[model samples]
Target: MYCYPPHPVRGHPCDNISGNYGTWQANAIQREVVVVGGGAAGLSAARTLIRNGVKNIALLEAQDYLGGRVKTHRQDGILTEDGAEWIHGGSANRLYGLARRMGVLSPRVPDSSYAWSAKTETGRNADPAGYDAAETLYEICERNSVLSQYSDFGYGKCYADKFSGEYRRNRGRRSERAAWLHFLEMWVNKDTGLDDWRDQSARDADHFTDWGLDQWDQWRAGYDALVAHLKKDIPAGTISMSSPVCKIFWDQGDKGQVLVVTQSGVSYLADHALITASVGHLKERQDSLFEPALPRAYRDALAVTELGLADKVQLGWRSSWWGEPHYNLNIIFTNDIQGEKSWLKGIMEFLTIHNQSNMLQAFVPGEYARKMEALPEETVKRHLLSFLADVTGKSIPEPSFFRRTQWQKNVWMRGSYNSYVTVEGGNTIMRSRQPLAQAVEKNGKPVLLWAGEHTHTTRYGTVDGAMDTGEREAYKIIDYMDATFG
Candidate 1:
C-alpha cells in the first residue's frame, strides 16, 4: 500500500549531520521532497505532504501560472475556459467534492445536444434520415453489450463494420450512410479527442465508468479557483513558477541524494522527487531530460501510451447567433462531403460557455487539431468564420475577440490529454501506471516517482485522476520519510 526508501535513517542528514559533514551538507540545497509540475497532481501532492506534516518541499512549474491544463481566460466581459471546463462526475467526483467545498460548483448542463448541417437546412431539427442515424448511434452508445462484441477491434472500424452492414440490410441510401458515419465520427472525436475512430480502442472506450447520468458540471468561478483553494494551506514560497526542470540526477555518488536541476540552472537536492509532468512533455523530453536516462521499460511504456490533441477556439460575439441555449451544439457537417479532401473533417462540437452569452467554443481534435496549431491566427479565424457561415446558412460577423489554445505548441504541455490507442493484446496504460521504480533506487535510496492523469488507468484524462495521482505520490513520499526516519 505504501513505498519507502530501503535503508532507514534518522533525521535528515543535512539537519543533524551538517556540522560533521560540512563540505557536502553545507553545499547541498536540501529538501525532504521535490515535486515537479504545478498542475493538479503537483498541487495535490504538496497539499497531501503539508497535511501529513512534511514542511521542506519545493514545487517547480514550467509555466508562470499554476493549474497546468485547467486554465481559464477572460476576454472582454465573458470568461472562457481554454483548457478543462467540465467536472465529469458531478457530485460523486473527487474534483467536484473539492469544488463544492470551495463553493465554485455551478449548475449542471445537459450532457449534449444535437444538430444537423445539410445543404438546404442547418439547425437542431434533423431530417428523417439524419434523425434515424442519430438515434441508431445513440442506441449503440447505450448498448454496451453490442459494443463488447468488438473489444479486440478499433472502435471506428468495428462501428463501421457493424453499422454499414446494418444500413445496407435496411436499404439505407449512400448519402444517409455517409451522414450516419459523419455523426458517429464527430461524436467519437468529441469524447476521445481522436480524429480517426481507428486510433481508439473498442475495449478501452467502453471501460470508462460513468459516475452518473448528469455527471458534467462547470465551475462558476473557473478552474483557477480550485487551484488556488488547493494551494491555500501550502506555505508561501513552496511553489516555484516559470521553473522548468531540465534534468534529474538520481542515485548520486555514494550517499544517493537525488539532484533536480531546472532550466534556469538552480539545483535542488531531495530524498525523494515526484514527477507529475504530462505524458506528452515526458515523451518529448524523456531522452535528454534525465541524467542517467529512463529505464527501457519506462521508455517502452511511454512509447505505447498515446498523448492526444484537443484544441479549443473561443469566439466572443457581440450578439448570440445560436437559436437557443444548449449545453453543446453538435455540428454534423454533411453538406460539404469531399471524402478525404475536406478541411472540416476535424471540427466537431461547439460548447456554450456557462452564462457567457457572447462566447462560443469550438473543439478541433486529432490530426486536424495539430494542423490548426500550425496555421496562422488570421487563417484559423477566417476558416472558422467560413465554416460557421456555411453551417448556419447565414453570413456571420467576425468575432469581437478570438483566442485559441495551442497545447501542442506549448513546450511544457505537448497535448491536451491522454488517449488510448489500440495495441493488439497490450495493456499499455496499466503498465505505464506502474511505479517508475519500487523505491527509485536499487540500494533503497529515494529517487524519482511519477504522477499525472496518464498514470491513472481507470480515470485517465480527467482532472480527478490527476488529483488522485498527486495524492498517491505524496503518500508514497510520506511513507518513505517515515521509514527513513524511524
Candidate 2:
C-alpha cells in the first residue's frame, strides 16, 4: 500500500528568491511594517495586519523557503514531515481551524485498529506488563488536573515519583516494572526533548491550554498548505525570500522610524518591525542582531528558557512489510546493550504515520539528537536498519527511501520543536515569559514588537501558541496606533 499520489510541485509563493551566494548589493526599501522570519508566527502576523487594512507589509525570510518548522519533505512518492506532524488540536486550533475552513485536511487513519508489539534489544519479547506500566504513565501525564497538583515540582520529580508510586501500588512484577521503567526514562527524554527532566518546570506542563477539538492531523496537500493559505491574501512580492535580517536598528533613524538590514545589506525602512524568529534563533543572534541590544530583562528571560532538539529518522518502502494496518514496534533496551552505536538508545519505537502507508518513523530527541544528526546518511541508514533487525529478530527488508532531520544544524531553525521553561537556568520570576513577550518602545510608542510561540503565556511550545502570539501582536498594533509600550 502507498499514500496519496504526489501533488504538483510548488515554489510556494511571494519568494524573492536570492541568497548571499552571488555578488552582494545594498539597497533600502521602505514599507509600513517589516516582518522578519517567514515561519508560522511571521506569516500569521503578516496576514492579520493585511486583513486589518495595514498594507505595505514586507516579510523578509532568511531561508529560501517559508514554513520554518512546519516544513514537509517529499521525495519520489514518499512524503514525510521534516518538522511538525500534528496540528495538536481540532477546530479551536488556529491552524487546524483554517485548514477546516479551507477543506485541506487529509483523511484520518483508523489508528485504533492498529497492532502493537514490544521487544527487548536482544530479540526477546518484552514483558507486556512493562509496556502497560509505561502506557499508564503516559495517560497520567496527559491529565492536566493531575499535573497541576505538582505545580511547584520539576518534571523529573513529579513523573518519577508518579511512575514509582503507580507500579508499587498496583503490585506489578518487579522484573516487568524494571523493564518498562528503563523504557520510561528514555521516553521522558524524547517526549520533553530535554537531556534531563529536572530542568523542565512542572509549572510549564500545567500551563498548557488545550483546545477542545478531537482531531489532530495533517493537511491534504502538506503542512505548507497552511503557509500558502496565509500568504494568499498578503500582496505578492511582500515576502523577500533568502533575505536574513542581520541587524535591526529599531531606534536609529532620524525620521522616528526603524531600519531592518538583511545579510545581503538590503535595508527595509518601516514604521514598525514585527520579529517572529524562533527563540533558538533569537537566543543565538540576540547580542549582535539588535542595535541597542535587547533589554536586560528580555536577555534574562532568554537565558532561563531553553529550546530542545527532536530529530526524526524515517523509512519508506513499496508496501507494508510489518503486515498490520497500523503496526507499532516498541524496543525496550536492557542494561547490557552498549558500544559505538549507543546513540541508537535514543530511538524507542517504530510507529506508522496516520495517512501514509509506506512510511514508518522514530524520533530522537534530547542529548543524542545532535550526535545522531552529525552522522552521515549512509551511516545512519546502515545503523538504524541493523538496530531494527536486532530488536525484531526478523530479516527486515531494506527500505527504498530513508531520511532524517537535522533541525539543530539548520542555520535558521537552530533546533526542533519549541521552548521549555527551565527550572533554574536563572531566577524563575514565577516562571513568567512576560518580559520576553513585551515590545520594545521608542518615544513612548511601539517600534519593535515580538511574535512567536515563546510569547504565549499558557500555550507555549505549540502551533496554536505560535498562532496566538502572532495574532496578539498584530492586534496590539491595531489597538494602539499610538500608545505606551508595556
lDDT of 1: 0.70
Off by over 4 Å in 2: 1-27, 169-171, 176-178, 211-215, 253-256, 425-427, 482-486
Highest TM-score model number: 2
| Candidate No. with top lDDT | 2
TM-score of 2: 0.89
Error of 1 at 223 (Å): 1.4
Clashing pairs in model 2, backbone N/Cα/C closer than 3 A: none
Put down candidate 1 lDDT per residue, 1-486, tens digits, no spaces: 112123222231111211222333345578888999999889999999999999899999988889998898875567888788888766678778777877778876554452323332244333345435544654565356866776666667656766676566556666557766677676667557776777766666566555753467878978788888888979888989887887677766676777787665667888788999987777767755676876656666666556778888888777777655553555555566453325456765566667775668877787778877888888888877877776666788878989988988887787886556455423344322453323356367557788888777567778888898899888877887689786
Error of 2 at 445 (Å): 1.2
Query: Residue-wise lDDT of candidate 2 within 1-486, one digit each (tens)?
Result: 112213212332212323432222234577878989888889899999999878888999989888888898888866788887877666667776677789987766554766888888878887776666666876677578887776676766666777767777666667666666767866777766777767777777667676632455678778888788878987888989988887777775554577787766677778889999988877776766776877777677776777878889999778887776678888877665465577788877888876676778998887778878878888889988888888877777889989999988876667878578777632355366777788887775578899888778788777667877888888888776644323
